[model samples]
Target: MSYVFQFGPILDRWPLFLHGALLTIELAAISTFVGLAIAVVLAVSRSFGPRPVAWLIGAYVELIRNTPLLVQLYLVYFVLPKAGMRLDSNQAAALALSANLAAYATEIIRAGLEATPRGLVEAGLSLGLRKGRIIRHIILGPALRSVYPALGSQFVLQILGSSLVSAIAAEELTAVSNNIMMETFRNFEVFIVTGALYLAMVLAFRVFFAQTNRSLFRWAA
Candidate 1:
């Protein structure tokens, strides 16, 4: 089948595409922050809490990791409404993405926490540091350092995965591209531009994370 090459029509709707891209970024940002917070709590619980708490977190991580994100998104969007818990498409998408990212982040952070040296914990105790203080200052720092790159990669993936939100008419970049393609009748050209835009967004996120790492972990530098 032959495809049309109408870059002009796609370019004409640049403003709409720009709006969608901005929304995508905003959604990703909000989800990432929420996910990271959930991750920190879950990782801490898994690593340092009672056996039951640890087991619960482990189950949550396994369940989320084993399942497909699309299924999770669909369940959040469709099934919840049937249960009388209504949420709009964008809210459902954001909640699903945040929860999914939290699972991965939990595992990554737990690994980092596990890698912390026993001697440091002993040192903190000997220095009269409380368990909470040790975990907050000594452990959290090195643990985060160990997992920084993985966390950054996960954040980037979260941004890409946000594209799937478009399926629910969240008006993100991919959804905007679909509309553009339908309007312009230039599926290939519209997708090519959309793909480039996503790549640019990912690169921008990488740069921002790198700078954040430098500032946050000055000792690592």
Candidate 2:
């Protein structure tokens, strides 16, 4: 027996797929920004804050890093609603993805922070710069420059992993693919197209990061 492939029906849903792809990108972008912000705070606190505060942040990092993101999503979407803190699918997805990315970003950013030269920090202080100014002008930039590649890779991973949000019915690319497959009954064709879309998205992310890196950190390179 021979098997035939029919992608015509799946291709017919291009608008649906495009919408899903856009939403996936939006979720990843928002999560990356929010997560990076949280990560910066956590990394700074753990680096210089009081022992108790550092310990608490450390525990959060460890907890998120050790657990599965799926379980975390379940807790955020299902369990939190039971506690009267209801969130829609997108909100829950954003929260879970942000927290998840924050955990990994914390360590990556912390490594960059630790790699910063002590002399630069001293120089900033000698110039009568405040702690915030020193960190912003002297430390944060270099630290982020040092870890820009890693951060970019993490962002890509987060984008790909955004598929997990489908568990909560977030209407992202994977969810749309599922719906297409069900409606068209072209499971293999739908998945092949979906996988190709994901690949294109990942490549697009890489190109974007490369351009951004050049624009933002060419001097550091």
- Candidate that would win on TM-score: 2
Query: Residue 89, candidate 1: how far off, in angstroms?
Result: 0.2
Q: Residue 79 in candidate 1 has what lDDT?
A: 88
Candidate 1 C-alpha lDDT tens digits along 1-221? 97556688888889998998898899988898899999999999999999999999999999999998999999899988899997999999999999999999999998999899999999999999999999999998789797987889898898899999988888699998998878777888989999999999999989988888889888776
What is the clash count for each candidate, in the order shown? 0, 0
Tell me the lDDT of candidate 2.
0.92
Lowest lDDT block of 10, candidate 2: 133-142
Error of 1 at 189 (Å): 1.1
How many angstroms is residue 134 displaced in model 2 relative to the true structure, after the best TM-score fit? 3.4
TM-score, every prediction: 0.93, 0.94
Candidate 2, pairs of clashing residues? none
- Give the runs in model 2 whose Cα sits over 4 Å from its true position: 124-133
Considering every candidate listed, which one attains the maximal lDDT?
A: 2
Model 2 RMSD vs true structure = 1.6
What is the alpha-carbon lDDT of model 1 when measured against the actual structure? Answer: 0.91
